[model samples]
Target chain A: GESVGLHLPTLSVQEGDNSIINCAYSNSASDYFIWYKQESGKGPQFIIDIRSNMDKRQGQRVTVLLNKTVKHLSLQIAATQPGDSAVYFCAETFPGNQFYFGTGTSLTVIP
Target chain B: EAGVAQSPRYKIIEKRQSVAFWCNPISGHATLYWYQQILGQGPKLLIQFQNNGVVDDSQLPKDRFSAERLKGVDSTLKIQPAKLEDSAVYLCASSLFGRSYNEQFFGPGTRLTVL
Candidate 1:
């Protein structure tokens, strides 16, 4: 069975500090992975995505690292802000566009 | 360009009652998706369509859930005889297919409560 899981269900970080959230996917065939940020009363928004061909990708103060050997993915947020407090989810796509999502990690940025 | 649009920010109904939600994706986007997101959980794909053709509905509970994307534009999802566990936010998203990298644009979801 294919599964993507987060190491932490919840995390707290200071507003000015960097925060890292980790995820592990069981399927080796998952060629594409993405991180999404979802705030309260809204839908999940795309954060960043990395293909298996690359080990790392960066976007606007965010980076996604993929470790195929360990089948792990991580999202790093620089300078966490109060607005960054939201649930983060990792999703993987295989042969098709259909994506499977992980449980999600709720992030709380304390000011 | 407008983002995906969903109606009725919230809905509440009793079990066995019927409900429906509407979604209008960005114009000319060939792919549309509907997802169910429970509290404290990630969104689950309930149905997907590519130009009015069903791409995937494997996880959709067909017995109670049905979705249609007529004319490859706006879409709707209906639940007949709802269940207590059906309480969740329904999200709609769209992506331009055949592009180099397809990134979906999401709309504010519709929260549903079942009694």
Candidate 2:
């Protein structure tokens, strides 16, 4: 079955440094991708999103890079903060507005 | 603007018991979604509603799970004769429209523990 997967299950980063999380999706037909942050005991929060036609999109202190050829996506956060500690998930949208999510990458920001 | 809202933040029930979760999407949002997220994993879409009409439910465990969105505003997800594996966080999300390009706003979620 086609699925989205993360390269690393856990990541630890020093505060004030940059952090990167990677994801690989198997579906070639997917046209939209999103990154979400889920804090403990909370639902996933929308972070950033990129369209297949665009290779990169940037937001406040965050960037999403999409590589259609390899079906790879990456999320980059600058000046990592303790509040950034959480599980991050990458999702691909299929037809009918259905989304498929990867397992997740747990990010821990050390102060 | 107010975000999505869900009720009964936490629930604990023995296997075979029934449980129900509720959600109210953002005002005037025409699309609603329900997802199940187990610990250490990402959320899995269970069902989707477009203005009180079901659009997709292929991933839903029809034998034990059911959902309804009455009046195209509030929705409920029900699980009957639950199993231990059913334990997970039920998340509700909504978007302005049912399109791949629309961003979905999520609720806090309901944590369900089935013993």
Candidate 3:
């Protein structure tokens, strides 16, 4: 059985502060992970992705860290803005399989 | 490049009423997907298609849900006698192919309200 879940259902951070959202997966066989951000009334948009081989990956304003030993993944948003407030989801996928998405964490940026 | 397109940005109907949603993938995309997302939750895959062929539909509620991609380009998802629990956003996504490593671009989802 494979399960992905977030540590927190909601997170609030001050504008311009850093935000870290955590996720856990039960499938050790999972080799790839992706982060998606969905705004109100819109479908999810891709944020960043990390392969099992890499422990950390960085994008423009986001960073994904993978801890294979702990079966945990985390996404860090730098200088969070009002527009960055959205529901974030972490999805895991093994080779030759569809991705399994976590419940998701709502991020609220307080100005 | 144009992204995936879905129709009926919003739909409201009473329980037991049948409703259908449509999706048109990006031109040349060989793979398409339909997902159901309840409020405050992530999208749950209902079906996947690889050029008009069913790839994965293990989570789809076959008893009440049906979907088709007749031409390998456009798709339709229908819910028969919808339930109150069926209220959610139906999302469509597409990729170049059913590659496990490629990103699937998503479209504006259709909000379904089954009262």
Candidate 4:
């Protein structure tokens, strides 16, 4: 079955540095992608999203880069803070309303 | 505005027991979704409802899992004869129009532990 997957399961970065998380998806029919941040004991919070038609999209300190040709997506965060520590997931939506989520990457910002 | 709401932040039940979780989506949102999140993994969609009608439930374990949105406002998910693998956090989310491009607002989630 087609799925979305992350290259790394855990990442540790120093505060004030930049962080990047990578995701690879198999379904080419997917037209929309979203990045979500989930904190401890909380639900996923929307961070940013990019449409297939666009190559990149930016929101605040977060940027989402989409590579349709390679079916790869990346999320970059600048000036990483301790609050940024959490699990991040990348989700893809195809023709149907259903969304497929990646395994997720846990980002830890060390102070 | 209030975010998505769920009840009983945590639950502990033995295997083969029955359990139910409730969710109330954001006001005026027409699309409701239920997802299961196992530790160390992302949330997986269990079922989706569009204004009181089911739009998708392909991943839901129909044999033991059932969900319904009676008035298109609040919903409930039930699991009968729960298995150990069924122990996980259940999250409810909602979007404005049930559109593919719309953003989904999620709740805090209900954590279930099956002994």
Error of 1 at B26 (Å): 0.9
Q: TM-score for all predictions?
A: 0.97, 0.98, 0.97, 0.98
- lDDT score, candidate 3, position B113: 98
Q: Which lDDT value does model 3 have at A19?
A: 99
Whole-model Cα lDDT of every candidate shown, in order:
0.92, 0.95, 0.94, 0.95
Predicted structure 1: lDDT: 0.92
Per-residue lDDT of A29 in model 3? 92
Our tally of clashes for model 1 stands at 0
All models, DockQ values? Answer: 0.64, 0.83, 0.80, 0.85
Candidate 2 lDDT by residue in tens digits, B1-115: 9999999999999999999999999999999999999988889999999999999999999999999999999999999989999999999999999988899999999999999
Please, what are the lDDT tens digits per residue for candidate 3 over residues A15-102? Answer: 9999999999999999999999998888889999999999999999899999999999999999999999999999999887888899
TM-score of decoy 3: 0.97
> How does chain B score by TM in each prediction?
0.96, 0.99, 0.98, 0.98
The residue-level lDDT of candidate 4 at B31 comes to 96
Q: Model 1 over residues B1-115: C-alpha lDDT tens digits?
A: 8889999899999999999999999998999999999987778989989999998899999999999998999999999999999999999999998232578889999999999
Please write out the lDDT profile of model 4 over residues B3-81, one tens digit for every residue.
9999989999999999999999999999999999999888999999999999989999999999999988999999998
Candidate 3, B65: how far from true, in Å?
0.9
Residue A69, model 2: Cα distance from true site in angstroms: 1.0
Residue B31 in candidate 4, Cα distance off native in Å:
0.4
Q: Model 1, residue A105: what's the lDDT? A: 97
